[model samples]
Target: MISQKAKYALRAMFALAEATDDTPLRIADIAEAKAIPRKFLEQILLELKRQGLIVSRRGKMGGYQLLRSADDITFGEVLRVVDGPLAPLPCLSKTAYHRCEDCQDEASCHIRRVFANVAEATRDVLDRTSIAEAIASGQTEAMLDAQ
Candidate 1:
């Protein structure tokens, strides 16, 4: 399961993506809009900024904005940033793979084989679904339906 931090991050990103103007959104505004706690939102925003997912400014006109276009940012990327690898098992992780301590052979392990497929399918959908696609009217539902 993805962490609560990841869910908040996505909500914050969606709020930013929905911004039609160039104005940055304040942390309080994002928190209220997304129902995320203010302090937690600050931490999440800083992490996102460090990862180059969003940018922040200072002063009265200061807030946060997407560093990249919404269409260019995928759900998988954000999830990875906030929650680490998507793999159900460490051995199934492509970016952070670690062999199971008890598994004798990864090549023949039925558990590994099953989870590999789960991880692949999860990655496929998340990587293909962009923030823009998600916030668009009816697009997310249609995409899932087709999947």
Candidate 2:
């Protein structure tokens, strides 16, 4: 499960993506728009800024904006940044792989095999799903639902 922090980050970023202009969005505004707690949104925004996923301004118009286009940012990247590796098990991890201590033969490990598939599928979806694509998909789904 994605942490609330990651969820909030996505919501905030998605809001930025949807902005009609390149103007930065105030944290309070984003929090209010996304129904995120103001303090928690502050922390999440800071971490996102530190990761270079977003940028901040310091003046009267100071706020936050996406550092890259929404189409250039994938859910996989955000998830990894906010939640760490997508692997369900250490052995299945691509960024932080480790042998299972109790495993006799990695090749024959059924549990690892199952979770490897899970991890791969998860990564495939997340890595391919950009914020722009996600927004478009949601809009399409909503239209379909309405029809």
Candidate 3:
């Protein structure tokens, strides 16, 4: 399951994506619009900014905006940035792989085999689904259905 922080980050990204105009969105506005706590949102935004998913501007007309086109930012990227690896088990993680202590042989590990498929399928959906695809009306359903 994705963390609440990851969910909030996605919501915040969606809100930013919907803002088509050049003006950046304020932290308070995004927090209120998405029903995320102001304090928690601050931390989430900071993490996103650090990860280069978003950039901030200072001054009166400044706030937050996507660092690149929404189409280029996949849900998998955001989830990984905010919630770490998406693997269901440590052994399944490509970016942070570590052998499970109880597992003697990876080739014959039944549990790892099952979860490896799960992790791959999950990555397929998330890496293909971008913020642009998610925010469009009817696109989300169509994408999922096609998948």
Candidate 4:
């Protein structure tokens, strides 16, 4: 399941992506437009900026903008920033892979196998999904999972 924080990050980023020519968006406006809390949105956007997913502009009309093109920003990339890993188990996670201490043999671990498939499925969806696509469809994993 996609966390609320990840959804907000995507929504906030999508709202900025929908902007013309990197024009900045005030956090308040973005939050209101996306129905995110202003303070929380600020924190989320800052983290995204720190992660190089966005660029912040200062002063009036200053808020945030995508550092990269919407088409170039994949859902997996965004998900990674907000959520630690796509996989439920550390062993199943590609980026954060580490053998579970309790599991001496992953070859026979049913839980690891199931979660590995889930990770692959999640990654396939998120990796192929870009911000531009999300904007066009107006959909996110949250929306998909809600159904």
Q: Write the per-residue lDDT of candidate 2 for residues 1-147, one digit (tens) a residue.
A: 777777877888888888889789998899888788999888888888898999999889989999999999998898788889899999998999999899999999999999889999999988998989988877623422343
Considering TM-score, which of the candidate structures 2 and 3 is the better prediction for this target?
Answer: 3
In the predicted model 1, the residue pairs found to clash are none
**lDDT score at residue 35, model 1, on the 0-100 scale:** 86
Which residue runs of candidate 1 sit more than 4 Å off their true CA positions? 138-147
- Candidate 2 weakest lDDT stretch, 10 residues: 138-147
Q: Give the per-residue lDDT of model 3 (tens digit) for 1-147.
A: 777788889888988988979899999999998888999999999999999999999999999999999999999999999999999999999899999999999999999999999999999999998999898754643433343
List the RMSD of every prediction in angstroms: 3.2, 3.7, 3.4, 2.0
Q: Candidate 1's C-alpha lDDT? A: 0.89
lDDT of 4 by residue, 1-147 (tens): 778888888888778988876568888889888889988898899889999999988898688888888999998998899977888888887788899999979999998888778878888988998999977885654574483
lDDT of each: 0.89, 0.85, 0.90, 0.85
Q: What TM-score fits each model?
A: 0.92, 0.91, 0.92, 0.91
Q: Enumerate clash totals for all models, in the order shown.
A: 0, 0, 0, 0
lDDT of 2: 0.85
| TM-score, cand. 1 vs. native | 0.92
